[model samples]
Target chain A: MGHGPGYVEADEDMSNPLGLKAKLGLDVFKHDKEPHITIKAGMAGDQRLKKAIIVCPAGLYSENAQGEVELTIDGCLECGTCLLACGSEVLGWQYPNGGAGVQFRFG
Target chain B: MSQASTFDVIVVGAGLAGLAAAYTMAREGLEVLVLERGEYPGSKNVTGGRLYLNPIRDMFPDLWAKAPLERHIAHEEVCLLDTEGAVTVRYDGAELGTQPYQSYSILRAKFDKWLGKQAERQGAMIVTKSRVDEVLFENGAVVGMRAGGEELRTNVVIAADGVLSFIAEKAGLREPFKAHDFAVGLKEIIELPRETLEARFNLQGDEGVARLYMGDVTKGKFGGGFLYTNKESISLGIVAGIEALNEAPSTIAASQMLEEFKLRPEVARLIAGGETAEYSAHVIPEGGLHAFGKFFGSGILVAGDAAGFSMNIGVTVRGMEYALASGYLAAQAVIRAKQKEDYSAAALSEYERLLKESFVMKDFENFKDSLHALENPRLFTYYPRLAGDVMRDLYEIPAGPKARIFPTIRKYFSVGELWGMGRDMWRLMKI
Candidate 1:
């Protein structure tokens, strides 16, 4: 089926894959001075860390040029999908202190 | 250690469970303190935006009259989709539209904030922007917790934290996390004009629709997509098994899956002209009874997602009611313990007993195998595609003579496929 009559696009920008940055920008967030999550030292290349790339809803995990997994904590939904996909051994995860992380207005 | 910081009972997290516990206890003249990490009660809470009231209405007898519910769901639908086509089944029963409606669409931010106010009015003290940093123990029993560098003490502590509860784990009530036991959901609250939303969904005043899509929604993963009609917005989202998403031959980011799902013709038309108001994600505890660990410890109790209270059994997904019930029951157990001057594990075991005697545990026992049954990949992939292909052939009016309907449909159900279907049906019967 194709778009029927009277179909109005929600937003032109939505037609494109709303990248991680743009999707996260739609919600409210309070930035923390220090990232709440970090790849444990010397475990960046661990196989377990790779799963976060697929399961993190915000798409916060990615592989660098060296094929080592990297993570940016901004826009982290604090869903803990990464921590479950990758074990605690490869990632040090915690909710941003007290009131520092995301503040969802419509959750 | 000061008496000013101590309370009869302290509840962590201010979602449904925490609020319910505080409301129940505070109403009974027991001092109750609720701690929430977010800016407000629901700042970090998420749901598909529907709540079944039949199970919880009686539990909170007077609360529904003025609750800020969005709409009463009058339509139930399920859609099976393939790459090119889709099959949809809609159910509209007269009873669904009658008074004392079974369920209603809800927004957590609005609903939870109102519930917080109700709890506060009942004499419960709630402190927002406070996150529990440590679960303190004395003589191997939880006595209190530390939050925001302040040590708060209480006679009993209730861990009503959401899924991925650090409080539960730190108190030795839950085991290490397992990927197979959870699913991640991403949702967008797309706002539409009230008139447009009602007309588009064919809903009358205060009427709403709840639709679920399987198959291509999750790219054959073990999860599905859900849409709920709110008063002026649609809650559209996809839930995918973390393990399935991770172990698939080709990896696709969860965020990309949502974007694609919205583009599907069947979904796109429904949401046309809507403006996305917000985007949120949260992990759901879908592992059912098998994944449950200890829910109570000495001087402590676990409730809500923290205790794995959510369940999905194809047609209905429930959690909020379970959270409300469990929190209420936990409060009951604590009240009993306080009367006897006991906060030990043996006394708190009453919480589990109360659950087993209620619908909360009974429902879990009945459908404990649903998660395993839903894990079959063919249910999400092969079946939807087969149904779509069969439908396409049956509906096509070609240039040549049309084939007989029975034969055209029968051709695809080979003996092997029939046997496989039988096996899958047998497995499903267990739930």
Candidate 2:
């Protein structure tokens, strides 16, 4: 997913366990390798497994063993700068249902 | 039992308030239908985009276990700023880290969609892309709602259709909201690396911080800006009063003001190297407690922004909590009215009374002046510039003989034209 400047390619070398770093503001290439932290809950899917976790590194999108995971996130502070700059469709977005989602606890 | 109707109850708007009301009624065995004008719930909703947990505690006690929470807010910083600097007051607590968290950061698309699904699971029929054209009335009493050229009957009507609800207006529950009574807000959700977010704001784990800015960010206009930390993204935006904005010397639209706001050195540094994820705009009812119009009519009830219940007190922007609380209370009233087999205005007036009894109305009532003070222009304009100038002179390390800070402040205060600073401060004090 890191195709822009300073993007260190994700190595296909199976023998090398090290994950390559992506460009600034882009990281989900080998995010799955960031350790399988158990979530215990918070996912929607086959729930037979008593424990599950998906690691999404902090750049808005997180990748897991199941590939890019899509989750509904709310309570976002309304800042239009990032959306004005995002050039992807992976993020399905809108304000929290009116009267739902993030309240500027202190604004 | 061949009742000729699409559902027993028809809810217009798929927002949280609407969904909550529909869900509550449906869970109790009523055949409820939710009609949304957007492609989906939250699609047309806009908030500072933060969801407080107080209102949802009863409905989804284990929400953190299932709902998508961007970040659990552990610290909140409310900053008063000038062109060059800021003074921030922070309220940090370890209590916020646990269950029943004070608040969480969220993206509405995900939150509202999930909420709609939850409502659907409770047996309410949620229909999207259906605009409610009018409220169906019989003998001056609301009997149902009309949407997309289709009329649907119900025992009650919920107008949770957001700030400019036509249904409420059409029902004579509210008038067309004046520009001064409302605010135009523009926001952007920017994505950043988890490590970067944590490092920049000194956050640990999933803990997040919310920041509010007043003063120069709005070009001394009667509005403020906010920056909140999410899981891997930051929500940044500006909300300004439309009347004050229109009265400004410059033609900076809400969108343009947001652009300028983000470019400020303080905000720009935080979002530096971050990727813009989404851009959205919406209006907020900052009319405070005095703006709440008639909340209910014959067989109808209104909650959330539709009723002009948002409060814009300094350091706080509360609507969601009010919306959810009011929604729940409205549902309770509706259930009682249903049991009594009466949907008249008298039967439904319970919603208004109960809402007034709840903290929703109390808080709005207490801080009515805060909303007025925010619109006074001094907090956004003169103070920021004067304060910034003061800070620059006091903090700057000069090469020659040091000028005493007190005298500098006195001289500075004497030098600049305060332009109603005294009156603004006096009124703000009362606020």
Candidate 3:
């Protein structure tokens, strides 16, 4: 009975921290066709973008082998953490259009 | 049926603040419209899972009895965690368990949806899945807003939007965002059986516990972790300052902090057999009154996180009560302006005046220096380790001989450490 909608069983991986994708799977999201956030062109290699890799609670930001930061918006929590971490010059950020993005059922 | 293009009031974002303002004004016979950018009122909301009601109870006098509150908090705990050991202090006061309880554990998704219903019952028209894209201005005054590609007119607009308040920015009421002024929080709602939760938390019927963890929980960051016992689940999460996470000597994902916190021996055993029901993250305005910008503008007012109402004073963290109270006061100011048939900046300044005279402004003014005082790195690192070490040495029995109690405790407090402690204490006096 404790299992409600969107509940995901905790994985048994103890050696590694809970994977971001699995944790995001526990939330309800209404997908949007267009990405709501993007790393600004030419600014992907900006040092400011490095903060996004560390401060994004969803771990949506990562540095590629090219030393450029990349972002995936599928699991964006709409928390605005990355925006706050990386200034507007390096990231194009906005909330997903109305009714899209992660929806918290037990927030 | 054609909906009116104009409303007496348009409150953006259906969190606590917007709902409170809508409910207050609708009950006064005003045509209030609340625009929400989510599937439902609380669908985009998140909290640390507790609301302090004593400060806001009188503002919404009749709503508490039937509110969707999870449990009345009867116990308060603080856990200081080092890399290895921990020190915890629990307070179970008789007054805390009595009627007229001070606070309750809350789940915003449930409470906000219920609040929207209450506001509707009071004649407020709520439009869900409607995002306000722009603030409409006439002669440099806010006249309405554009949402869902439709221009909606209103005499005044209330920006009750959450922390990252774009509406307030669009209306020219806030300064540019600063990383140091905000913190990000990540929470997981872990579900368990009611009996198991009750037994684990030592709770009676409808009783709950609220615990805060510091030090290693955030990896010595400027924030901490929190756990609140719900009726049949637990809300566990971490709040780390964005600046702290960014400026750390090494890179660490904020989510990893929560993962490690859940594995701490002191926390792992409590929820050994629970399932995670939901995961959420939110940005909190932690800069205190110093970060507050122009809250009232020409025919526009800001409330809740949009106005930077949240604060962290080491022992307690609060925002919801301020949100609810500020929303109520904003409505009162609008009602007063309606009587004069004016929505000018001069007229709407009453909102700021009312806030200054209320507990909301008084509390902010009283603790305006809290955030700065808490920025000292020692509070998050040295102190916790010192506490854990002292406790360990005091309780541990040596192999052959036990050291004298005074020396065992006194050895850690060298002259330099004592001086640092004194300086920290003097800084905290501002709060």
Say which candidate scores most in lDDT. Answer: 3
Candidate 2 residue-wise lDDT, B313-341, digit = tens = 77778788777777778888888988898
Which sequence of candidate numbers ranks them by TM-score, best first?
Answer: 3, 1, 2
Docking class for model 3 is medium
Q: Which lDDT tens digits does candidate 3 get at residues B248-298?
A: 565578887788788887888987898787879999999988899998999
- Return the number of clashes found in candidate 3: 0
lDDT of 2 by residue, A55-80 (tens): 11112223357643333232233322
Model 1 TM-score, all chains together: 0.96
TM-score of each: 0.96, 0.77, 0.97
Clashes of 1: 0
Candidate 3 regions with alpha-carbon error over 4 angstroms? A1-11, A14-18, B1-5
DockQ of each: 0.47, 0.02, 0.69
Model 1 off-target regions past 4 Å? A1-18, B1-5
Ten-residue segment with the worst summed lDDT in candidate 3 chain B?
B1-10
